[model samples]
Target: MTEDNGGWIVFQRRFDGSTDFYRNWTAYTNGFGDIDAEFYLGNQIIFEITKDENVELRVDLVDKTGESGYAKYSYFSISGPEDFYRLYVNGYSGNAGDSLMYHSGQRFTTFDEDNDLLASNNCAEMYHGAWWYQSCHHSNLNGEYGNDDYGSGPNWYHWRGHYYALNSTRMMIRVRRY
Candidate 1:
């Protein structure tokens, strides 16, 4: 419900058996904040928690499937942060091929044209044309080099300007607090 230091977001829900079965309540982050925690109910009214102790957000899904279909269950969760976390599906009981697909965690930060092309301990830089030695430095771009041409680098870059020029091979850079 709140964003503290732009760090965390929380969501919660409770059911008092006021609605009918077969209804579903889905939640999504809208690509705004990182997910810190989660919980859900099993078919047999079991309580389940899905999140590490130190996450930033928590989601809970209470499955109150009354005399409905065969309790068909499906859920999806994702996070965007600096580090990576393991993905668990179907109570971590199903095989990888049978369970839903999970993607690697992504970290995103605002593009700083002044810092994008400059090399630093956290970023790398590459040139598209001419191989200008000064342009190859990391700290020059301030971490915002999207192209190889002049007037502020390319229109699209990735991995902190590690790659350049090619349409599809651009790097996908992300930012996170140190």
Candidate 2:
């Protein structure tokens, strides 16, 4: 396993039906790197891909901890892979309910599960990013992860520091990217 100068971590499998990460025979990266691409799993995701194309890999986050820290916001944000970029959330997609999509305001709410995640304070909206912000579990006025003494939220109005702190409101965006 080796790290390229551009910070792209790649993993490949030498044989099928192999689960030994060290023996799977592959490459790796290390140190400071740009998180250009990643995914938003409702839990933690730490794995390497070795020689595969379009295979459905599933990760479950049933009451997981460590990397996820608190279990509020989105859940998890990863900085790897390629072609995955800035996330845009949409809350208005569901009806009056605690839909993971509606409350959390995420584009991809779930990952190969029976249902998506519910309202997340850690990874909620654009403020949380792929990883959680600094401070507390609740995003503050500065859009950081803290109380900031303002309130514990039900906070709406994603202004400068606040990305999606609306009043339990749903956000729907329709912008084309290239």
Number of the predicted model whose TM-score against the real structure is largest:
2
Q: Which stretches of candidate 2 lie over 4 Å from their true place?
A: 1-41, 44-131, 136-149, 156-165, 169-177
Tens-place lDDT digits, model 2, residues 53-121: 111211111111212111112232223334121122232211122222222222221112111233344
How many clashing residue pairs are found in candidate 1? 26
- How does each model score on lDDT? 0.22, 0.22
TM-score of 2: 0.19
* Model 2 residue 156 CA deviation in Å: 5.9
